[model samples]
Target chain A: MSKKRDDIIDTTSDLLERQGYFATGLNQIVEESGAPKGSLYYYFPGGKDEICEEAIRRSGASLEKSIDRAMSEADTAAEGIAALVEGISRAMEASNFGAGGPLTTVATETAGQNERLNNACEEIYESWRATFERYIRKDGIDSIRAERLSTLVLATMEGAIILSRTYKSTEPLQRAGAELRELLEFAR
Target chain B: MSKKRDDIIDTTSDLLERQGYFATGLNQIVEESGAPKGSLYYYFPGGKDEICEEAIRRSGASLEKSIDRAMSEADTAAEGIAALVEGISRAMEASNFGAGGPLTTVATETAGQNERLNNACEEIYESWRATFERYIRKDGIDSIRAERLSTLVLATMEGAIILSRTYKSTEPLQRAGAELRELLEFAR
Candidate 1:
């Protein structure tokens, strides 16, 4: 990817992370990136929706990498899942509350309206779920239950971020971790 | 609230639920409510900021009541949580994967830039946490953990709705409910 395009995605992600996918405008992305109009159009010919899909994919990939990083750093899936939740907690705090998982806001805003964006988000969610499910399966969770558990964990983290932001606290994410831990114990 | 004021809130809420807070405009609200040009200012003396705040509060109250009703109908807090998640699941399905939440979208969109809307969202979220905490406490969890658990459940549900709406499926919410059930078994 060109530096100009990366800059565009980086700025758009930050803007969208702070605001939302819908609230962001192509002009804002260009303004934030300080990139020339010719470059933006040359780099992302498909425009905002296309840029948005790429940004969502990037957010999802980065999140999956974090989960993978957490998993690799731990001895067990349980420990890794715990670390992943807390990792998100710290990350959310660093974002000062408005920072939720990127895909949630985009997914909500584009669900029924933008088919291209919706498809990208669906696949992005699957990637995240698969990241969690890999560890769950390694730890002996049946495939069906593991998939469900993965779905639930993803949803909870996304949701918790929203409440945590709204209430300006990390306590929600922390408690949600405990609940997840308890359920994982039972799954084992 | 005055009839005009109520109309404004209802229309804004619906629009925000379908679109989002930032994406929604005063002109659209004025048009949708069929109010005179001065009616919005006359009723909401503070203008769009106040109207947005009031709309959030009204939407919050409605959501909180829906949760309370679902909780009351259930035999246990655990079941009530599931019922609430399922109720939202059905709503997401009914909406055919459009934006399923207004308060959440607004909270995420304005969490950093808008103080009035942010504070209003805070109050709304705090009230929800309190409501969930109240019922969970009735089932024997201590105050501290109950508060945390309430926030977690709220987050999980909020996240679930987003995913469910995006995927045009209830799998995320259903799976979230199952995991939640596993966690709540201790309380039961």
Candidate 2:
């Protein structure tokens, strides 16, 4: 991606993460991104919706890489999940509680309203579930149970991010991590 | 609340639920609400911020009542949680996937920007955790375990709602309920 286009996605993702899709305006995106209006139009002619779709896709890919890296660092599935949970807490704290990135806020705002964004979110979620399922499967869990546990873990982490952001504390995420670790340990 | 105030809260809550705080405008509030301009100011002199604050509080209280009612109807902690999860899927489906209602959207949108709204969300979340904790405790779980389980359950539900909305299906929620039921049964 061009520097200008990357800047646009970076800023728009931040805005959507902090505010939401419907609340983020094109003017704000241009102003904050410092991307020339002509360049933005050149890259994304479909306006905010087009820009948002790219943002979601790019963010999702970036997150998948991060999850892969995090999972690789741990020897066990439980440890991998624990690291992921704590990493989320630290990221939220670092961003000053602007966690969930653009994903959660945009997903909620455009879930049924916009087909393109909704599809992006759905694909992102499916990718995440599959990733977790792979980790759990490594622990010898049955494919069906691994898939189900993966879904539950993903849902819990997403929800914990929301709570952690809302309460401005890592306690919720930590507790949620412990709970998940117990569940995964049971499988072991 | 007076009829005029109630109208404002209801309308504002709906807007917050669907689009979130930054995207929901005062003009839209007044126009969609059909409440007299004078009445809006008379009821909430501080304008949109005040209205949002009230909306958060009122919505929180209403949800707390619903939680209490749902808990009352179930004999065991697992049953209560299952009923609550199914109820959420039903409500979201009925509303055509506007499931987060006031909590998920508003909390994410205003977690750090506005003190009043953030505090209201915190209180609402704390109340919800407490409600779940009470049920877990009633099942003879230790206080520490109950509290941890309560937080996990809350996070899972909030995350599941987002997935359910994004996928336009109740499967995420149903799967989440199954996961939580397994955890609760293990505790028993």
Candidate 3:
């Protein structure tokens, strides 16, 4: 994609991560992205929905890549999940709890209201679960257990992000990580 | 509170539960609640923020009561949690995925942007955690472990609600309940 398009998506993802969907205006995206106002329509003719859909997809893919790398680096699924949650905690703190959960706010805000955006979020979440399931399966877990465990892991991580962000503390994420680590170890 | 005030809060909570903060305007609230337009400002002098704060508190208190009742009815912490989650799943389905996590969208959407609302959300979350911590401690768990487990339970429930809403399926919540049950059982 063009640099302008990438910049727009990056800015939109950041804004969505913080303020959510409806609060994020196209004017704000144009101003923050420093891309020409006309370029937004030029690239995303579907307007805010298209821009947001692209942003969610991009954020989801990036996080999936991070999970893949984290899983590959650790010796066990438990350790990999621990490291992943820890990294999220640090990033959230670094951003003053403004980052993390790029898709969470959007997903919740649009769940039943906006079908197109809702579908995008559902797809992203499924991909993340699939990534976790693939790694947990490598740890000698049965397919069924791995699928269930992956869903729990994703739900915990998503929910912990909300708490950590709300409390403006990393403790929720840390506690979640520790708990998930234990759960994974027990599963193995 | 007057019946009108209660009506406003109830309607605002429903709107906030589904569409989030910014998306649910005062006009929409008034229109949907069928309360006089002037009555909104009369009831909540601080406007939308005040309305949202009350809505969050009401939702939190109601859910806490549900937790209390669920706990009292169950024989184990795991069973109580399972029942609570199962109830949430059924409610979500009943709302056609338009309900559940009454505070979640607002909590995440206003985490850092709106201080007053964020603090309300934080207090509600703390209350929920305390309820869980107290019950878990009663189950012969140490204070520290109870606290950690309570936080995990809250986070997983919040995250699972988001997934269930987005996917328009209660499977995520059901799966989360099952995993949490196993984790609590192991703790015992």
Candidate 4:
């Protein structure tokens, strides 16, 4: 991607992460990215929706890579999940308690309102679930149960983010991580 | 509540649930509620902030009532959770996959941005967690673990709402319900 194009995505992702799709304005994206209106339109003709779709995809892939790195670092699935929990807690604390990443807030906001954006979120979530299922499966859980458990894990993380952000504390995410690890280990 | 006051809240709650804090307009609330512009200002002198704060509190209380009713109907904590999950699934299906409720989207959207709304969301979550902890304790779980598990349950439910809404399916929620029930039962 061109530097300007990349800047647009990077800036838009941050804004979307902090605010839902409807709350983010195009002018703000241009101002934050330092990209001219003409340049933004040149890269993303469909404008805000287009930019958001790409941002969600980019963030989703980036998150999956992070997950892979986190999961690979640990000797076991349970430990890997714990590492992720800790990582998320640290990140949330760093942000001063922001729930739902760029992908999440935008995903929920556009779920029923925008098909293109909603599909992007759905694809991202499915990819994340697949990643979790792969890790859980290594622990000897069957494929079907692993799939279901992966969904639960994802839900828990997402929900915990919301709570942690709302309370402006990491306790909810930390608590969720420990409980989820226990549940996953017990499943095995 | 007076009929006009109730109308204002109901409309604001629906808008906030669908659109979050920044996206929900005061004019939209008045138009949707049919409470007249004068009546709205008369009731909520602080405009959108006041209306949103009240809406969050009202929705929070309403959700607690629903949860209490669901918990009361079931024979076990696990069963109670399943009932709540089923109810949420049906409601999401009815709304064509809107995640969470009035409380969730607003809570997340306003987290850290607006102290008043954030506090309202936090209080609501705390009350819900207390309710869940009470039920978990009834199942012979200790208080400390029960508190943690309650947070986990709330996180899972909130996260599952996001997924279910994104995929436009109730499968995520249904799967979470089963997994959570298993985990809760195992903790006993």
Candidate 5:
């Protein structure tokens, strides 16, 4: 992608994470990204949906890598998962509870209302879940059990992010991480 | 509340659930509710935030009652939670994946940007969590464990609702429900 295009997508990703799709106007993206106004449509011919779809995909892949890195740094699946949650908690606090759940608000907002954006969100969430599944499977878990456990972990983390953000406290994420660690250890 | 006021709040609740705070315009709420447009500001002197806050509280209380009813009907806390999740799954399917998680979109959309709405969301979520904590405690579990487990249950359900809506599939909620039942049983 061109530098301006990348800037636009990057800005969109951050705006979407903090304010969601409808609330994050293209003008704001241009203003924050310092991309020329005309360049937006020139680069993303489909307008806001296209820009948001790209942002969601980019954010999703970025978070997947973070999950992978967190998983790799720890000694075991349980510890890795706990560390990942801790990292998310810290990020949430750092952003003043505006940073986490990049796809959550968009997913919920557009689920039935906008088919294309909904599809993009579904794809990203599936990719994240698969990343978690891959990590869980490394613990010698059967495929079925791993799949279910990964889904639970993703769901819990996603939910915890919302709660943590709303309460302006990392306690929810911290509590979730502890519970997930216990569950993962038990599963092993 | 007058019938017109109730109608406005009810319409706002449904609109917020499906489309979120920013996307659900005041004009749409007036048109859909069929209440006199002038009456909106009369009933809710504070305008959109006031309307949305009332809607969130109403929806939250309604869901809490559903939880209480589900718990009352089942013999075990595990069974009741499973049933509650199942009901939420059916509701999602019934609405064509647009109805579940009434507070999720609004909560996420307004989390950091709107203090009044954010506090409304925090209050409702806390109320729901307390309800879950109560039922979990009734299972003879200790307070600390019940608190943690209830938070997990709430988070998992909230996340599953998002996934199920995005995928247009009920499997995520069902899987979360099954896993939650097992976890609750294990705890007991």
Candidate 6:
């Protein structure tokens, strides 16, 4: 990605999290990214949908990497998971809770309404779930259990972020992370 | 709610699920409900936000009732929960998976943007969680664990519905239900 394209994706991710796919406009993206008006069309011939698709994909990947970093440096998968959860909490603060899971709002807003965005969101979620599943497996959980565990973990994180942001309290996320970590042997 | 009010609520729910709060306009609600333009103002002084709040609360109450019904009829809280999960799957299909969860989307969309709607959704979620927590406690799970379990169930349902609707497949919901059942048990 060009520096300009990267900035466009970065800024769009912010807008998508803060608002939603429908509410975030090209004008806003240009205003935030400092990308020229024509540049949006030049880079993304497919328009907002295309830009959102790329932004959402990067959001998932970046989240995956963050979680990966948190886990890899931990003493165990359990701590890694804790770090991952805390990482999200920090992100919630960084975005002033204005920014949430990118695909969540898009998934809810456009799932049945727009097939293209829906598919993009679906891909993003599946990829995130898969990333979590890999970590769950790496944690030594059984395969059957890992998949389910990963699903729950992802769902919990997604839900917690919303609740924590909505209530302006981290209680939900804190409780959720504690519960999940307790499931692992690493809980002290 | 009056007959016309229910019609508007139902229509708004469908629109909110498929299109979202921002994308679904009062014009569409008026057109879909066949309610007069003046009627919306009468029912909701706050317009769309009020309508969305009412719809979300109604949907939340409906879901809580399902949980109560399932628990009351079940031999144990476990089966009650299982039945509730199954009930959600059927309900999603009944709604054509057009829109997933009302509270989830409403929370994400308006939580930060709209304070009144945000508080209403917070209360809705808290009420549902309290109800679920009540039964989970009755089922013998401890207090803290029960709350966490309820949160997990809500998240999984929300996530599964989004995935199911996107893929037009109920498999995620079903799979999520089974996993949820496990979490409920595992929480103990």
Candidates sorted by DockQ, best first: 3, 5, 4, 2, 1, 6
Report the lDDT of model 4 for residue B71. 84
Listing candidates in order, what is each one's chain A TM-score?
Answer: 0.95, 0.97, 0.98, 0.97, 0.96, 0.90
- lDDT by candidate, in order shown: 0.81, 0.87, 0.92, 0.86, 0.88, 0.77
Alpha-carbon RMSD, each predicted model = 1.7, 1.5, 0.8, 1.2, 1.1, 2.3
TM-score per candidate, in order? 0.95, 0.96, 0.99, 0.97, 0.98, 0.92
Runs of candidate 1 exceeding 4 Å displacement:
none
Q: Please give the distance, in angstroms, between residue A4's alpha carbon in candidate 4 and its true position after superposition.
A: 0.9
CA shift of B65, model 4, Å: 0.8
Ranking by TM-score: 3, 5, 4, 2, 1, 6
* Stretches of candidate 4 exceeding 4 Å from the true structure: none
lDDT of 6 at A47: 95
User: Which of the predicted structures, 2 or 4, would earn the higher lDDT when compared with the native?
Assistant: 2
- Per-residue lDDT value at B57 in model 3: 97
TM-score of chain A of 4: 0.97
Give me candidate 4's TM-score against the actual structure.
Answer: 0.97
Say which docking band candidate 5 falls in: high
Best by lDDT: 3
Error of 5 at A122 (Å): 0.7
Query: lDDT tens string, model 4, B1-188?
Result: 69999999988888877766777898888789888899998999998899999988988898899998898888788999999998988888888775467777777666767788888889999999999989889899999899899999999988898899889899999998899999888888
Clashing pairs in 4: A17-A102
Candidate 5 lDDT score at position B8: 96
True contacts kept of each: 0.77, 0.79, 0.88, 0.83, 0.69, 0.47
Per-prediction DockQ: 0.69, 0.77, 0.91, 0.79, 0.82, 0.58
In terms of DockQ, the best-performing candidate is 3
Expressed as tens digits, the lDDT of each residue in A9-99 for candidate 3 is 9999999998999899999999999999999999999999999999999999999999999998998899999889878888998999999
Q: Could you tell me how far off, in angstroms, the CA of residue A97 lies in candidate 2 after the best superposition?
A: 2.0
